[model samples]
Target: MTAPQDHAPSDVPPAPRGGAGPVHSDTTQSAIRQSTSGMPTRPHGDDVHAAAGSATQPTGQADWSAFGPGGSGTAPPNTDEADRPAFEPDRGGTASADHALAEPQRVRRLKIALMVCGAAVTVGMGVAIAVLMEEASPPLRVGVASRPTGSHAPAAPPAIGGSSGASGAVPGNAGAGAAPANAIACPLPGGPAACPAMVAIPAGRYRMGSRRTDPDAQEEELGGAERAIAPFELSAHEITAGQWQLCVNQGACPPPAQPPQSSTMPVTGISWDAAAAYAAWLSQQTGQPYRLPTEAEWEYAARAGASTVFPWGNQLGQRHAHCGQCGTLPDYAGLAPVGSYPAQRGLYDMVGNAYEWVADCWTPSHAQPVPPAQSACHEKVQKGGAYDTLEADVRPVARTHGDRATPDVRVGFRIARQLQRTEQ
Candidate 1:
């Protein structure tokens, strides 16, 4: 082995020395110094080095000169040993410090997630409250005018209480140019030849509705209330087909569904709005407050101071009015001439002929009182029975209702004028 060179094998131990000697190779000494550079100086450093050298040595010959304190391969002892702690692996301590430093970041991340979740929940509730406010509004109304053309024909005799004069003028004509001192001549476009007669109703108070104990009283007619009425004038008979035709001719009102079967029959198939429009047209033509009668006034006038169901009596007589089975019509008991029935208080067909529209809103029962002043309403009140009505419905107190825009052949209306104080 050529004298085994000068270096010993790295895994071998030196032979027993007479005094202290190096026990490790240069490479092993360098590794130990790098690993324990930050370790504290110990009183037994040489002994510890010897023990490390012995533990790493293989079971063979090796040089130990390089590991000695003054050997050329040895590094200088660390001078910052006192300022640094010993090289002890602080696994638990270092891990705890790292965890402490990282804890706030984890908590911050957790808080950010919570805030994001909370914000998401709050935005979901604000969208639900805006949808409920748009569904509570009322409806609107539209009006259209329609009329048909024809020649002015002779009107049949007015219904009961109507004047029989050939001039076609109402009795006591006293408007614009007339004779009666207490009445104003109705402003008819055709002069006295185009209008029906009107009756002067005196101002007074009367029981307006039916008594609750009355035999055939409906809940809506059971209040038996008394109303003080102002003096007003009413058409003697329901508006005849000839009279309505004059309105149509003047282009002030719409034409009926069919031309008058006879000029004497009451005009039918009219709606409350159409009737109101007619009254407005008449007001313009006559320069008077022509309108529909109030419910209370209509009932009071129809009763004619009689406490019985019909104007004549409690018993329904065939000749008393034109209802379903109680009319004088021969074959079919359909609509009859306006004056076919008897008159009460100079007014004709107060109980039967056509269901008349009044100037009051509909109420289910008389128990609930309506305000006296007029206002907009969806449904309107109708009074009196129609030619097609049953006997029980012909009572002066019988009541009915319909929508403001509805039209029926059995329905019609008459005009009312507020009496001037002088006229009254």
Candidate 2:
């Protein structure tokens, strides 16, 4: 999607408004609900194993009643060896006249007995084979179509793509029974004011900083190491002026130095402190914890499953972002409206819009311990280069910092909310 140039500021639609509940985008609510609703509950591995075991065992004994006399379900008592009749042949290999009558009767009885015994053996073998076939079969899965013989195991849940260095889990999955942030539409708290659309970011681990070997790597971003992040929800787009205005209307946030011409434009000229205040105000209204994303989180989301220098690729492609000298924009001097560009990992304007405030202090280098947020703060971290940023500066690893209380036209912030879990 490209920025709207023909439409006037008034022609641009206001941001979506939600009713009193968990907030999400209006477009995605039905889809998310449908997806989650239709999604079959995954069977536990242990449960599947248990089912397989039960299927293999013999269900019951085979009926052999037909072989029993009078259908009594029991075989007749065995005859003693001495009582069994034996045939005798004369010198010519033929039965003599005196034993001819007895021989015929004995032979008939012997053949009948043998036939009954053979039938019993055959029935027993059939039962054994049936049990074996059941044991070899795999447990059936619900909502998944059965594969042809010799096919691979049932397919896994579709992978929801996310940041690099970690496999994607279900997209926008918060927990059991919880919908993804973008999919669930709810009302904004306190009034009918519009709320920022949120995207659910799955939990994953990745390298947090740049390596020393890289030419564009910053000293502050070196000595990077793998870091684990928890599941959380972030605004799909940079917080728009219309959303901030709602907070200001409630007297919960400070006014911007210069109001945006269009409500859809990302709100700038707001201090880090003001951003934090807006987060707190949102938490109070929605009864959900809201705050700024951590520095590591910002990088991970910006990368959006890409390991390249830029989320799109190693090079800064045209119209991918709004940055100075980045090219492909009608106006590089000013910020475009929110969602003016494509999304990464379902997040929009992560790299080139306004430099976003993160919830971390500006340490000199990666070697030093990160200062705690509770402690006295000096300069806070900002990420995702701004409109005036060069191509090299508009990377996931790029960072800038300023006094927490000071506001700049090049800076703005997004909101992140915690994912709550419920008992299954």
Candidate 3:
């Protein structure tokens, strides 16, 4: 074996040796391919041989977790040259010609990395559906705060007029009080004093008026006119024509062909069925029932609880109301009694000296269940509206109409009730 050390091997092949050619020894690649297939071998040569030094096999170093065969996922233990085994077929190793052209280029780079992860999941689901369609749309709202826009100004409307703070209409103190016992009888059939004189009002919920109808006191221009109204109670006065001659002395009020020289003045030209038959003869001589207030309960009882429109709020003049103010009578010329006009609205000739009558019953405007007194068969709603009307018709829901029979100095009526049928 020592003699075999006279080597020239690193797969020897420099060619042209003496005394017998064709002897290439890469150790034994199947005996050098069975002694050089078909001969004419050119396994390179070595002149006299005996060069010595190619007996390797001592390459020590292999710990990649003892590699291959044991765990099986192959390839790590070859440590550079542990007897460098593989080569043969006359040692023509060129790394097996680049691992046979790199196995189909690793299956074409794994199908181009799964088509670039499915087009990045279809462009991130089309940008999350365009941010959920801009968060589902619809919301314009500006005004920075409202009434035209921001910087805060617009206020001021009060001196005697303000209401409609909640906006339902007609509770200007529907004639001040009394009401709560109606099993039915409001027919006023002929009981002379027909109705009125109930008065107590109280349970509270005010601030009515302002559905803004003063567009220069309107002939019909009508723009955003939602004049509001609240509070409630009124009638503590007016209905005088000598108190409808005590219902024509009780023939159930039919007499006034035109009498009344002055029972202290207040009643006027009559008719909401002669002021609901004199407030149903003062609610059947005081058993308590009454009726007539729904122009929002007569301006929510004429702003009794006060939010304004003339219980001394928006100031219409005549010092505050008696029409023509200090213009010294005659303009509306008649009616005065019922506390001669003053309580701003807490009571008294509502706001002037004439236009009374009002247990409601008309609606070419106001709107609500309020149409009962025979649905305008002729006329019946009236609230402070005359003295020829004009300082914005003396507000507090100012309105007018007549003919429940006729009688006129300017027309008069007041009183209201039905708080679930009056009597308490």
Candidate 4:
């Protein structure tokens, strides 16, 4: 008389009464298969128990509680979600599907961060390198000399031979403080073609003494003042042995006590009187005035329009001049070839190589008044320093005294000519 009991389809299994057999829905079987695709199978006895426990489960109820203790419907308590695998599903949706969707975005963010860091490091290195380069460079120096004297004199005109009493005198108003308009270069007649050329020095006033506070200035070089000079022509280099040999071959000059290293070496070991005699002979032959440079004229030409100790700068360097500290050769290895070092204003060896004999009577200091005329020459002033001298002694203001008749290997002389005006 009871209603017929609801029965499952003939292809499906039936649920047991009183929960004696487990009931498993299609969802639970599928979830188990997916989760355990690669897992080792359980023992035959455990498999039978799991099959019986899950056989009668209903659909839409695939919680892991079925496999937990006592087959209870409640799921196990979990405190940390991070313990779950990326492939596991959550309450909201399948966890593996959500992870697959968000993985590309996480990778993209990581790549962006790495790119930004790399770019920042590159920029930082570039900035550091730029700072280093700036620090390694030297500062430029400009306008280190005193103000110009507002004079622009032309180069000397070529020399012309003429008979006139004024040709031997100082030209261009020597004592009247007038700038010379012309300078002449008179070539030595019958002299060797290798003789050093002459340079015209324009008449101008220049500071005649070293500054008292200068590091290289000596006590004798102090008390400097502005001095006026007349225009003149000076030899471009110290007189070489070859140039002097021309006079020697003609019996116009005496032979050196010791032979020079080379014909081009500067003629050293010549006395002041011998240098003056050479100048006189050259004047008579070339028909122009030639003599030793006066003390003021020697300094002006050596300064070469610079107010520095050397023509180049206060500090001495190898390429500028040769001295004991220059390191080019052994100390006092004799003289170097003319123009072996640098030149300023067409003059060489103005600071070193050989001490130059100037046309002034030796005075203890520049403070002493120079006599208007020569009384009797005792000691002559020598400007420029020799190769064996200290670098500080090579300064233009530095001076030393030597006997006029004594010949020294370290002493040499350069000739100067009074510039003359020619009638058109």
Candidate 5:
């Protein structure tokens, strides 16, 4: 008798190429239908050929080759048509007619492999997403970490008012004995509440000059050493017009060569001697130690915890400050008003607002140290490059010297105060 042809179940969908969901077949459904009809199922042995030729073949069919008497779980080897078995197994397992009811072995293995692969893909995606999120947002730092004198490790800028007292009040200013270890810079006791706004600076260390490989390095900015700065307070903004005018009105300072259009704008064209006189007048009025920042202190403050050429970064960005190559805005003809740009570490206009005078006397190079003083200085150092200053010259380490008696439209100044002993 002729062997019957093997046929695949209609309910089972084709297996996917790569790892996909589990494979399902109609093995259980076929058995349920046959048992419900009270039909005695024919064995897959010699009855298939007789059933096929007599037109009495069962419609409810299942693959049972793997569990049959003479069958293995895998497909049989290839042979001639006449010698081959009547049924062939699907990709997962062997096929046969000897057994009436049994699940194919290959289908179970395919389902297990697909389930494991699907689980692995899900876990891999979860880990990748978590890593990306962490890189996108770093945590904020609450305290300053000490660094070796010249270490180039990047430091995060502290929050406004520093990690110490919030109101710019330090324990040192309260009394004399060893102050609380956490107390930072504050205005001296008895200072007016409305004195030029100041931001407390934490004690820190930094390299004092341009790197040896800098292309813009000048003789005066080279051969410098590392410096350790004590805690102090620096003016939040460059000295404004109203602030300078107050000094002139009290007769403690000479009138400016040109009046500023707005009281909030920085006062310019003031000689170094005149700027020093204003600082002295402010100290007397507010009862705070007010003076020009030393050259080293000015550079350190301007850097604002950055190691790049510019405080913001290495490249020049639009509207960062009012410099020639730093980009322009429609607001002003000359200098933008004080606090017009975003601040760094609570201090505004550290660079590119105006040329600020420092407390150092101008020497040919940084090889020799110049002591900071408010008097008896011939040539004074200028920092924080002016609005018209070139981009190449608008870095923390860049400097220019001016005659102490001369005042230019581009030159201006800000003040700094030292932190006193903390309260015991």
Candidate 6:
């Protein structure tokens, strides 16, 4: 079977919008619905437990037919056990044996006693039944599936990748759901207005940061920062040109979607403000929500499950990345559509090509010796080192920040929207 996970960047260029027209204009109106159907149920554990309990005891299923439809002239004597549940003794009378009881009088006394005892036994049985009903159900336990005595291929387990032996949790969550912001600037491979349609990254946590021994860990490459970064989410691909158009169409940003994007290329030419506006617009349309990933999330996704500087691994491979390739530097002078390189960071163009914007406002978390006279705020960090420089420009922790309002030729962005609600 093919492995369930593999993160190789796509080299495909922008696509034409001819297939599906743009997504709906208002994303906020998109509703997140929960089912209104009745809750599903399985047989209660107590029911089984009660059945087993009754089996152990001598009590039988209730049957009333043996007495006949009406009292029969001929009847069998009552069994002693019928009165086993009740015990009562009659009080001695003050005028006992004063005279030999008459034949009818003696018989009448005996019949009255039996009648009283039968009534008491019936009531006791009813109370016992009620008590049995009140006990809690039995506990549930999962057991191994029954396998045929002799089989060829083994059965696959239900959990994800079947890695963990335990049954994973039934998928669901309770929540109304999700938003927030920042102005980030990135250099695009192309001008703004032509970014392509972006892929939806289902909301999930991913690991980020890198291990030592990476090129960035070397003396020459570790130039900007040193600190531990938390995990976060990122868009599957870079922001597309058409997505930016949605924000402009809403009248939030001045520039409209431009010409170059065929619908699949990464978005470019947008300043940080434009990207932030698109995020807000998307949230409102879903009637639910959306937001850019935190800086931690962005890097986590970029790492693509790897602890290396790039998603592919530590040593840079020319064919895998687009930056400073061969004897020549491949910055290429402009944004070249998203996914322009597959071997780069397990995601397209991550190493070089275009510096992508992140959600954090310009600032440094642990920029080494720490900025002496200033706060970490006021300067943003960028990832996927860009072209137009030595190889150092592409280290994972590389940092830089520029005007949020102005677009840069070498910078671009991708958009991210969070899920509205999960199951309970």
What's the distance in Å from true for residue 127, model 6?
A: 99
lDDT of 2 by residue, 393-413 (tens): 566776656677777555689
lDDT order, best first, reads 2, 4, 5, 1, 3, 6
Give candidate 3 misplaced runs (Cα > 4 Å): 1-237, 240-243, 246-248, 251-265, 268-281, 285-300, 304-306, 309-313, 317-322, 326-330, 336-349, 354-413, 416-418, 421-424
Candidate 4 similarity to native, TM-score: 0.55
lDDT for each candidate structure? 0.50, 0.54, 0.40, 0.52, 0.52, 0.36
lDDT winner between candidates 2 and 3 = 2
Model 4 agreement with the true structure over 248-281: per-residue lDDT tens digits: 8879899865567666677877878888889988
Better of 4 and 5 by lDDT: 4
Candidate 4 residues lying further than 4 Å off, grouped into runs, are 1-196, 330-332
**Ten-residue stretch with the least lDDT total in model 1:** 14-23
Model 3, span 4-113: residue lDDT tens: 00011211111111100011322221221111111111221111132223222324433333433553324433334434555533234454444444644554464456
Give the number of colliding residue pairs in candidate 3.
98
What is the per-residue lDDT of model 6 for residues 1-424, given as tens digits with 9 covering 90 to 100? Answer: 0000000111111000000000011111011001101211100000111112341333443233343334331233334444523443322331222222343354456557766776687677667764443221111111111112222222221111111111211122101111111212222233332322223222334323333444433221233332333322244356655556565676865562234434444555566666667777655654434566655555544544444444544554454544322111222222344554442222345545455667666532233433343224434444554332223345444434445555543346655545334589
- RMSD versus native structure for model 2: 23.1
Off by over 4 Å in 6: 1-214, 217-233, 256-264, 326-333, 343-346, 365-378, 387-389, 419-421
Top TM-score: which candidate number?
2
Best-to-worst order by TM-score is 2, 1, 4, 5, 6, 3
Greater-TM-score candidate between 5 and 6: 5
Q: Model 6 misses residue 118 by how many Å?
A: 99
The candidate 2 region of ten consecutive residues with least summed lDDT is 14-23
The residue-level lDDT of candidate 6 at 9 comes to 11
- Segments in model 1 whose C-alpha atoms lie over 4 Å from true places: 1-183, 371-375
